[model samples]
Target: MLSFNILYSQERNVYDENIFVNCQNEKLNWKKLELNSTEYKYTLISKNYFASDKDVNYYNGLIILPIDKNEENKNVIEELLKLISIEEDLFEITAIKKCEIQKLYYSSFLTEEQKIEVKNNVIGKLRLGIKN
Candidate 1:
């Protein structure tokens, strides 16, 4: 997921965590939940404290990728950029991309421990920025 900040009326991607992918003029950030030799799983939140809004619920999702892969890998982030598109200045998955990713069962990608951490910690803080 990607967060956005409007600075001097120019939109930019702002993230609390370090960027995991930056390619083709697009940037993305994620939190690592699990890592191993073959692959790792992470969650990317489209919403941040400064960006809390109705879209939060829509754009949150998980991603799993091979550990051997890096930004230098051919079309690594590019393929991801295709899966998670930025719309209206915010990173969001279109219905088509969402369906494609959904088929991969990203939720099942996380282990039980990661699930608890995400629900208890991540979800609790998901919309903390929104005005009451």
Candidate 2:
């Protein structure tokens, strides 16, 4: 398995970098953005997009990270939704408050071309949102 670290600034800005190599052969560069006074954003910029010939899938999983579940980070979710624009019928957001380390795992079976498309789309949206 691969490992990564998401570093957060005192002001709440978040950035991530890979810590180890794994079989997935994925490279990610994360950027930090402030959504507002109290919210921050973390976005992934991959070295290569997922293949296009495969179908992308989303699964329900638990997030293992450091997050406060007391509604204090509500703006984070709102900012994420604004950035990614999830489909109403296919995506849903829920919060669980039992752990200090939040973990989430989702499987995306996208072809290389499709992965690239998704990366471009997501980065484009994030760029637009941050510029505004």
**Sequence-dependent TM-score of model 1:** 0.25
lDDT of 2 at 34: 41
Off by over 4 Å in 1: 1-43, 51-74, 86-112, 115-132
Candidate No. with top lDDT:
1
Off by over 4 Å in 2: 1-23, 44-67, 84-102, 105-132
**What are the Cα lDDT values of the candidates?**
0.29, 0.28
Worst 10 residues of 2 by lDDT: 123-132
Which candidate comes out best when scored by TM-score?
A: 2
Instruction: Please write out the lDDT profile of model 1 over residues 1-132, one tens digit for every residue.
Output: 234321210012222231122121233344333222323234444332344455432222223333333335424433433332332133332222212111122224344544444332211011122122
Q: Residue 59 in candidate 1 has what lDDT?
A: 22
Candidate 2 lDDT tens digits, 1-132: 222221111112221222111213543333334445644334443222222322332211111112343366545554554343332121332222221222221125333543453342211111110100
lDDT of 1: 0.29
